[model samples]
Target chain A: MDLSALGSCVSQVSCVVTQTTSGLISGMLLFLVSCGLTLIFGVLGVVNFAHGSLYMLGAFFAYTVYVPTHSFALAILAGAVGTGLFGIVFERFFISRVYGSDVLMQLLVCYAFVLILDDVVKMVWGASYLSMGMPEAFMVPPLFIAGGVVPPFYLFLIGISALFGLALWLLMARTRFGKVVRAAAQNGDMVAALGIRTPYVFAAVFALGSVMAGAAGALAAPVRSLTAGMGFSVLIESFIVTVIGGMGSIVGALVASILLGLIQSFGAIGFPLFTDGLMFTFMAVVLIVKPTGLFGQRVR
Target chain B: MQAKGTIRHGVSRRAALKGAGALTLASGIGGFPHIAKAAGKVIRVGMNTILSGRVALVGTSSSNAARLVIDKFNAEGGAGGRTIELVVRDSKGRPDEAARVVRDLMDVEGCEIILDSEASSGAFAVHEVMRTRGVLCIHTNSETSQLTADPKMHIPTVFRSARQGIQDAVGGGQYAAAIAKKKKLTRWMTCSPDYVYGRDNTAQFMEYAKIFDPAIRLVEGAWPKLFQPDYTPVITKILQEKPQALYSALWGGDLSAFIDQGNLYGLFHNIDTFAVNLGDYSVLKAVKSLPKGLHSGSRYNRIVPHSAANEAFYTAYTKRFPGQWPTNWSWQNATGAAFMCDALKKTGGKTDGKLLAAAIAGRTIKSPFGVKGTITMRAEDHTIIDYAVAYGITEPVDPYLTDIQMADWGAILEHEAEWKKKKGYA
Candidate 1:
C-alpha cells in the first residue's frame, strides 16, 4: 500500500476508536439514568414519569451540597440518599395508592408527580441555568488514547457507572432479598400469597432506582448544564433506552443505552441535524421488529 | 367636558371617592402613591414578558428594571403628572400565549400602552395584537431584525427599543474581522442554536464578516438544538475541525453549559471564540468561570457604555436587586420605560396610541449608551437607530468586558436600507 493510503487507514481507525470512546461515555451516562427507570418498572409494575425529576433533584442536591462542603464525592452521596428518601416518600404517598390500578390511572399519578416536582425544582433553583465547576481532579490534562485525547472526567464517569452496574447486578442476582424482589417482579400476587411483604420490596426497588438516577444526575452535573428542563431532555432519552432495551430489563437497558449512545456519537458526526431523528428511527425499527423488545420477556 | 362633581356610571361623587379609597387600600399602595394620585390620574401600561419557564430570568430582570423606572417616574409626579401603573402578563415564551395575554392586558386590564419584552417570535405575536387593537407598543428585548427592518411588518403604533439582530451582526462581524485580519486568523466556524434567531444572526455575521475580510473562510456550521443541555459532541466536533475562530450565538443556559463542557475539552484554547451573546450578564453569571480573552459583543456590560446615566442605572439596578448584575434586557427595558414616559409627557398624558407613536417617531432620546449622543427612533421603520455597538474581551469579575472596541452605527447601518430593499422588505 502507498504511504498516503496507510496514513489514511490509520486516520480512519483513529476516528473509529475516538467515536467509539465517545459513544461509550455517553452510553454509560444513559445507562445510569435508564437502569433506575427499568428497575422501578420491574419491581413496582409502574412506570415512574417523575423519574427524570428525581434525576434533576439529584443534580440540584449535589449543587446545594457541593456549595457548602466543596466536596464532590459528599455531594454525590447526599444527592443519592436525598433522592432515595424522596422516592420512598413518593411511593408511600402516591405510587402506593395507585398500585393494582389501571395503567392509565398509574400514569396519571406519576404525571402529576412530574408536574409537581418540576415546579418544586423551579421554585428552589429559580428558572435559570446553574452549573457546577469541574473538580480539580477532572481538570487535569486529557489522557491521549490512540490518536485522540479523552477528557479524564469521561473516564471517571465510565469507571463509576461500571462499578455501579456490577454492584447492582450482584444485589439483584446474588442476595436473598434479590431473590424475593425477582420473584415479586415475576408474580407479585404469588409472592404476596407466600407472605413475602411485596410492598416493602417494591418500595426498596423504587428507592434503589431513584438512588441510581440521583447518582447519574450528580455525575452529569459537571458535564451538563443544570436546568429545570434538563430532566425532560434526559427523560425522553431514558424512555427510549428503556423501551429499546426492553422495559424492566437491566441488562437490556445497559446494552440498548450503549447502542443508542454509539448511534448518537457517530450520527452527530455523520448527520448532525438528523441525530435525534436517527435515535427515534432506531427505536421505531426495534419496536416493529420485536414487540417485546430485544430482551423483554413475554407475559403469560 | 365631564363635570367632576356629577355622577358618572351610576356612582355618586361621595360613593366614587369611597370606592377609590377602598381600591387604594386594597391594592396595597401603602400611601406612597397617595401624593402621586392626588397630582393626576393613573395611566396603565401593560407589559407582556416571559415571566415563567426557561427564559424567565430575562423577563424578570427587564420587568424589574421597568418597575424601577416607573417608580422613579411616579416619585417625580409621573409623565405630565399622570402616575404610571405597570400591569405585567407572563407570555411563557409562546407566540399564541403572548397574543392572548396581550389582548387580555389591553381589553380586560384597560391598559392604554403595552411594552413587550418577549423573544422575537412572541414579539411578532404581540405586534400583531397591538396593530389590530391600535395600542402603542414598545418592544424592549426582541432582536429579530425583520420585526422592524422589514417594511411589511411595520406598524405606526409599534416601535422597537431593542437593538436589531442585523445591527449586532454587522457590528460584531466587523469587530471579528478586524481581529481576524490583525491576528492572521482565517478559518471560521459557527455553533449556534438551531432556531430562527440563531441561524439568522450567524448567517448575517458571516456574510458581513466576509465583506469586511474576504480572506476569511467558513469551514463548518453547527446548529445545535435550542436549549440542548449537553454540548459534548458539538465541542468535540469543533475541536476535531480545528477552526482558527468560531462564531457562536448560543445564549442563556445553553451557552453556560457549552462553556462549561467546552472548557473540559480545551476548546477555548484552540479557537478564537466570538460569541454575540457572551456579553449578557445572565449567561456570564451562569458560567462557572469566564475564560480570559473570549471575544464577544452585542449584549450590554455597564462599563462598555461608560456614561453617567448607564452607571446610574447599573448602580440602582444592582442596589435594588442586591448582588445581581444588570442584564442587557434590564437596560433595554429601562430605556423603553424612560422613552415611554418621555413620549407620554410630550403628549400631555393623552393615551392616544397613534399620537404618542407619532411623537416618539423620528425623535432622539438621550440614552446613556448610543451613537451620535442619543438613540433615534427611525421615522421610516420605527426601530431605534444608532445604539451602541461595542465588542470586548471577557474578564473574570463583574463588568465582564475589557479592551472595548466601539463600532460606528453609520458604517454598520450603511447597507441596511439597500439590503432590506434587496430582500424586498422596503
Candidate 2:
C-alpha cells in the first residue's frame, strides 16, 4: 500500500484495538450481573425473575449510600451487604417452599416476586430518573493501555472481577464448606444423611448470589445512569451471558463476559446498527453448536 | 360442583327477574327523567395522557398547559354557560391502558368531548370512540403525521393543533441539512428514538434532505429503544462510523439521558456537527456541557429577541413558576390550549362539537410564536400549517439554559404548498 493509505490502515487498526478494549470493559460489567444469576439458577434450579430487581436495588443502594457517604468503598459495602440481607429474607420467606417444584410453578412464584420487588422499588424511589457518580477519590487519570485510553476505574474493575473469581475458586476448591455445598448440589439427600445442613447452605448460596449481583450493580452505577428500567436490560443480557458461559460455570462467566464485552465495543465501532445483535448472535452460535455452552457441563 | 352450579343458576335467575322488573320501571320513567337530567348539565371533557413512565414530563406539562387554558375559559364562564368539566386519566403510554382509560372516562363519566389524548396510540384509540360517538377530539402534542392526514387511519372528529410531521420535517430539515452541508458534513446519520414519531420525523427529514440534495447519502442510522438511559454503545458506534452530521429526534427522558451520557463521552466534541431535530430547552438544560457549535432546534425559544407575545408569555410563565424556565414545547402546548379556548369563546361558549372542531381547524389562533394568523387547515388533509424554526446552541447561561442562534428559517418553509398538496387519509 502507498504511504498515505498505509497510514490510514494503521489508524483504522488502532481504532479497532481501542474499540476491543471498550468491549472488554462492557463484558466485565455483563459478567458481574450474569455470575450471580447463573449461580442462583444453578443451585436453586429456579429462575429468579426478581434478579433484575435485586440488581436495581443494588444500584439504588450504592447511589443513596455512596452519594451521602462520599465513599465508593462504603457504597459497595452497603450495596452488597444490604442486597445480601434482602436476599436472605426473600429466600427464607418466599423461595424456601418452592425447592423441588415444577419449572412452571417456580416461574409463577418468581414472577410474583418480580411484581412485588418492582412495586417496592417504585415506592422507594418514586418514578423519576436518579443521576449518580462514583466518589471523587476513585477518579483516576485515563489509563493508556492496549493502544486505547480507558478509564483507570475500568482497570480496577478488571482486577476486581479477576481477584473475586480467584478468591471464589480458592473457597470452592480448598474449603470443607465448599465441599459440602458441592455435595449438596449433587445429592441433597446424601449430604443431609451425612448430617450437613443443606437448607442453610442453600440460603448462604442465595445470599452470596445476591451480594454478587448487588456489588455488580454498585460498580455499574458510576458507568451508567440509574433508572427503573435499567434492571430489565441487565436481566436479559445476564441471561444471555449465563447461557453462553455455561449455565453453572463461574470461570465460564468471566471468560464469556470479556468475550462479549470485546465484541460489543469493537462491534459498536464497526457496526452501530448491529452492535446489540452481536452478543445474541454469539450466544446463538455457541448454543447451536455446543447446546450446553462453552463452559457448561452436561446434566447427569 | 353440582350444588354450586345450581346455587349460581338460582341466584342468576332471581337477579334476572329483579333486572327485568327494574327495566320495566326504568322504561316507564325514562324520557321525562332523561330530559330533566340533560337540561343545564355540565358537559364532561375527557383528557387522557401518559402520566407515568419516562414521558411523564410531556404528560404533566401538557396536563398543566391544558388546565391553564381550561381555568381561563371557566373564569370567563364555560361553553354556553355549561361548565366544561375536564376529567383526566393516566394512559401509562400504553395502547391497552389508553383504550381502557378512555372507555372508563366515557362510560363512567358521561364525557362529551375528548381533549388531548397525549400519545399517538392513545389519540387513535380515543379518536375511534369519538368518531363512533360523534364526539369532538382535539389533539395537542401528538404530531404523528398521518393521524389526521392519512385517510386510511380512521380517526374521526379528531383535529390536530401540532403541525403535520411532513411540514415539521420540511421546516426543520431544510435548515438543518443546509447547515450540515455548510459545515462540510455532506454525509449524515440519524439517531432517533425508535418509535412512530421518531421514525416518521427521521424519515421525513431524510426525504427532505434527499430532495434538497440528491448527493447527500445517509451513511448510518441508529434507533435505540425509546427512553433507553444509555447511548454509549450506540453513540460510540456512530462516532466510529464518522458520519458528518447526526440528527437526533429523541425527546424527554431519552433526550435527557442522551445529552447527559453524550456530553460525558465527548460524543458531540468528536463529531464535526450534530443536530437534535426536536432538541428543546428541557433536554439542553439537563446537559452539564454542550458542544460549542452544536446545532439544535425548538418550536419556540424563550430567548427569541424582540417578540411581544413571547415576552408577555415568558413573563407570565416565569412569574407563576419561579426558577423553572418554560420550554419551547410548553409554550406550544399553551398555544394549543389557548386555541381551543378561543374557539369555544368565538362560538359564545356553545358546546357544539362540530363548530368547536371547525373553529379550531380553520381559525387563526394567537400564540407566542408569531402574530395571530390562521392555522389554514388544508381541506385535503386536516393538518395545520404552523411555525417552526431551527437554531444552534451558541452560549450557556446560569439558569441551566443555553442561547440558541437562529439559522435559516425561510428555506425550511419554501415548499409548504407541495407538502400540503401531498394527500393521505391518516
Candidate 3:
C-alpha cells in the first residue's frame, strides 16, 4: 500500500483498538447477564425467557433503591439481591413444574412467565419510562480516545465484570455448593441419588445467576438509559454470548464474549448501521464452524 | 352554574370539599392510583411506541418527547390545574400488543386524552378506543390517512402532526418524476417496506408519477417485508431492473441497510436520483457513508427555517441531549407538544378535554419550524392538515450526516398542493 494509505489504515486499526477496549467492557456486562441465563438453562434445563425482564428489574431496583441510599455500591447490591429473591420465587413457583418437559412445553411455560412478569412490572412500575440521575462518581467525564470521549464508567464496567468472573470461578471451583451444582449439571440423576438435594441447588443457581444479571444491569444503568424493553435487547445478546461460549461453560463465556466484543467494536466503524447485526452474524459463523462452539464438548 | 352542578350531578358539599383536595395534590403522585386521581381531576395520556426490541430507537425518542412535554406543562401549573399524567406502554411493534396497550390505557389508566404511536397499526388500535370515548388523541407521529378517512373512526380527538403517508408519496413521487424528466431519465422503479405506511407511500408516489408522465415505464417495483434486515436480494432486483431512477420509502433500520447496499453497487452514479420518504436524521445517524446526490423527504429540517422558536428549541434540545438532535420524528414530537402547549395557554390552563379539543380544532398554533401554517383540526375528519419538507444529499459531515441535504418544507408543501390540485382532490 502507498504510504498515505498505509498511514490511514494504521489510524483505523488504532481506532478499532480503542473501540475493542470499550467492547470488552460491554462484553463483561454481557457475560454477567448471560452467565445467569446459561446457568438457569443448564440447571433447570429450561430456557428462562423472562431472564431479560429480571435484568430490567435489576436496573429499576437499583434506580429506586440507590436514589434513597445515595450509594452506587448499595444500588448494585440491591439489584443483585432483589433479583435473586425474585428469581427464587420464580423458579420455585413457576419454573419447577416445567423441568424435565419437552422443549416446546418448556418454551411455552417460559412464555407464560414472560406474560405474568410483564403484567407485574406494568402494575408496579406503571407504563412510563423512568430514569434516574447517574451517581456523582460515575458522572466523571470519560477518558479521551481517537478524537472521541470514552466514559470512565466503561472502564469500571470492565473491572466489575472481571471481579464477578474471578469470584464466580473461585466459588464454583472451590466451594461445596459449587461442587454440588457441578455434579448436578453433569448428572442430575446421580446427584439426586446421592441425596445431595439437587432441587435446592437448582433454585440457588437460578437465584445466583439472576443476581449477577441484576448487578450487571445496575452498573449499566449509569452508562445508558433504562426502559422497560431494555432487558429484551440484552437478553438476546446474552443468549448469543452463552451459546457461543459453550452452554454452562464459564471459561468459554469469557473468551467468546471478549472475542465477540472486539468483533463488534471494529464492525461499528466498518459498518455503523449493521453493527447491531454484526454480533448475530459472528454467532452464526462460530456455530456453523464448530457447532459445539469454541469450548463446547460433544454430548457423546 | 353552581345550582345546576348541585341539582343535576347531586354532588353534596362534603363530596365537593374532597374533590377540591384531590385537585390540589395531582402533580405530586407517581403511582397508578395516585397519578390517576392527581390534581383532583385526572387526565391520563396513554402512549404506545416501540419502547424495546430492535425498533426501540424511535420509541425511546417518542417516550422522551412525551416526558418533556408533560413535564413542561405540569411545571406551568398543569392544564386547567388538572394534573395531566402520561401513561406509556411499549407495543414492541406487534399489532396484538398495541391493541392491548390501547385497551389498558383507556380502560385501566383512565386517560382522557391519548397519544398514538409512530407505528400505523398501533395508532389505529388506539384510535378505536379513542373513538368510543370521544376523547382527543394527539397523534405524535403515525402517518395513515385511512384512520382519518373512516367515518366509523370519527377519531373525536385525533389530530395528526406529521404529513400522512399519502402526502409523503405525493410529494416524493412528483419530486422524483420531475428530477428524472429534467435529467432525461426514462424508466423508474420503487423499493419500499411492505406495510400500510410503506406501501401507501411508495405506491402513491409511483401512481402520481404515472399520472404526470403516462409514457414513462415502471421498470420494476420491490416491496420487502417490514423490518427485513437483509436488503441484498432487493438490491439485486433493483440493479437488474436497470431503472434510471429509484424511489423508496425505506425508514429507520431498513433505510440504513438500503443506503449501505445502494452505495456498494455504485447505484448513486448509475441512477438519476433516489427519492426516499422519512430518510432523515435517524437514518443518517445509523449509516457510516452515503452515496453522493441522494434525495430525501422530511417534515422538519434544522437548517430549513431560521425562526425564533426553532432557534430556541434547537439550541436547548441539542445542549441538553448531546449526540441526539431533533430529527423529523423528533420534530413532529416537538410540534405536537408545542401545539398542545399553545392550546392550553389559549384556554388559560383549562384542560377540559372537550374545550381544549375545540380550541385546537380552530387554532393555527405556531410551529417550532416557524412556518405560519394553520394546524386546523378539520371538524369533518378531525385530522390536522400539516406541511412537509424534503431535501437532497450534498456532502458528508463527521460523526453524522453522511446522507442527503435537508429539503425545504415550503418547497415540499407547495409541490404537495400543486399535486393535490392537479388530481382534483384539493
Best by lDDT: 1
Ranking by lDDT: 1, 2, 3
Query: Compared with the real two-chain complex, what DockQ does model 2 have?
Result: 0.28
For each candidate in turn, the interface RMSD (Å) is: 1.8, 3.4, 12.9
User: How much lDDT does each candidate structure score?
Assistant: 0.84, 0.67, 0.66
Per-residue CA lDDT of candidate 3, range B148-170, in tens? Answer: 65555555556776566655665
Of the two candidates 1 and 3, the one with more favorable DockQ, higher being better, is 1
Candidate 3 chain B has its poorest 10 consecutive residues by lDDT at: B398-407
How would the docking of model 1 be graded?
medium
lDDT per residue (tens digit) for residues B85-109 in model 1: 9998898899999999988776666
RMSD of each: 6.1, 5.7, 13.0
Candidate 2 local lDDT, B215-262, one digit each (tens): 678877877876564566666566556777777887655665665555
Among these predicted structures, which one has the highest TM-score?
1
**Which sections of candidate 2 miss by over 4 Å?**
A1-11, A66-70, A133-153, A189-196, A269-278, B1-40, B151-156, B209-217, B227-230, B273-293, B299-333, B369-381, B394-413, B420-426
Deviation of model 3 at A209, angstroms: 22
Against the true structure, candidate 3 has what lDDT? 0.66
